[model samples]
Target: MKTIQVPTREQVNEEAQALFDQLQKRLGKVPNLYATIGYSAHALQAFLQFETSLNQGAFTGKEREAVALVVSQVNGCNYCLAAQTMAAVKRGLTQEETLLIRSGRASDQKMNTIVQLAKSIAENKGKSAQNLLAQFFEAGYSEAALIELTGLVTVRIFTNYVYALTAIPVDFPAAQPLPYALQEQPQS
Candidate 1:
């Protein structure tokens, strides 16, 4: 069961209410994740801010989606995986591109650079590998853009951990996990 109930548009506060209204207006419904995050107004505001900024990231639409997809895969967050996949497709990623990011291997030569860097950063928990950061910089992202990407990743971690705890039903099918593959098993 969810630790927090997913309050309907009416159940949310008049002050915290705008978040609900905005979500419904933009996404047609409040995501279960957002509803739960509404327990704290700051949490909900942070999520919305990060989401909007990341959506306007320095990378092109597809490039930003690729970064999101790679982070979702590494985090092993099925909810994020599905949500981002849907966003990626809507942003014009080919089905093949989506699969590649979900699988942690980009088939597109140009995109492989971004995917590898994003994966390395996620795996390292933001203690970014120096060489990889250099590579990401060399690939043309500015320092400011890198900061924005970190903000984006942090927001994702918030959602990913929430799902791990709640196991909430993914309202967006794009949030599913990649196909089963070699992954570390929890030790007894």
Candidate 2:
């Protein structure tokens, strides 16, 4: 049987190798999920470009990380949760803030709207976000910002599904369990 394995930079095509080198220089390591994507050079390049473009959109780094955290948590993707939790901290979110965002709220009203919208979209598969969308705009987000936030959510879902499909080793520190997961059960 063929076991799934994340490819090394050397195992991929020239294009993917270059992208791996870039990731190494920028992040100090090529994350396992990205390495698995390197199996298809075109996919790795496209995913990287999509992510980089979204980074230039209306959301600040902290806001983007917040969206990532909430969406990943909603999708129950441990890999993305772990990675985004670390990114959230780097973006200046404290551990408490990350936990709160994962639970679909934030202390800042504007961010609460963002997290609630992201969570609603993920939980409803984007089919039921109307109310949250209205709240998002009322919270002072522009149409352009909405587009950017949606793009952020889409990218996070892509990574989350990738982790689901591949079950690649999470290279970052594990995220703490969500509050609901930690609740003790009654004695059977």
Candidate 3:
């Protein structure tokens, strides 16, 4: 099997270099997934723009991280699962709560709805059932929030697929493996 090389900050073009410098300043290092995108500066810039825009949207930081956790779990992307687990902690979720979110559950009713909807959207490829959509709004999310949630799911999916394709080395601390009982079985 061939390994996809993650580009070093030194190896990327000027645009990517600037982005890497910024990322390093903020995050202390360029994560391998972002570095993979750095191989195409335009792609890196576009992804950064898209992600930053979503961060400014209707979801609270914890809610957004919840969406990311459930989506990453559904997609079985360990790289994102690990990264988002850490991000979720920084956003104030207890490690146990993060694990529960990944398993499509949450102690908070509203967040449970959000995680379930994100899981369904990702597992079903954006073809989530109407009842799930209704539940999201019934839980008090606006149509605008739903739209933003969909966008967030799409962004996470992009990174999930990228990491899956590249089999990139995870740069974050390894998340605890989802217990077998918590693992979602593949739909037949």
Candidate whose lDDT is highest:
3
Provide the lDDT at 147 for model 1. Answer: 85
Cα RMSD for candidates in order? 3.5, 3.1, 1.9
- Better-scoring candidate (TM-score), 2 or 3: 3
In lDDT terms, how accurate is model 2? 0.88
Candidate 3 worst ten-residue window by lDDT = 176-185
Residue 175, model 3: Cα distance from true site in angstroms: 0.7
Candidate with best TM-score: 3
Model 1, residue 128: distance off in Å is 2.7
Please give, for residues 103-139, the per-residue lDDT of candidate 2 as tens digits.
Answer: 8888999888888888887888776467888888888
As for model 1, its CA RMSD to the true structure in angstroms is 3.5
lDDT of each: 0.75, 0.88, 0.92
Question: Can you give the TM-score per candidate against the true fold?
Answer: 0.84, 0.92, 0.94
Q: Residue-wise lDDT of candidate 3 within 1-188, one digit each (tens)?
A: 88899998889999999999999999999999999999999999999999999999888899999999999988889999999999999999999899889999999999998899898999998888899899998988898998899999999999999999999899899888888877768999
**Model 3 residue 67 lDDT?**
94
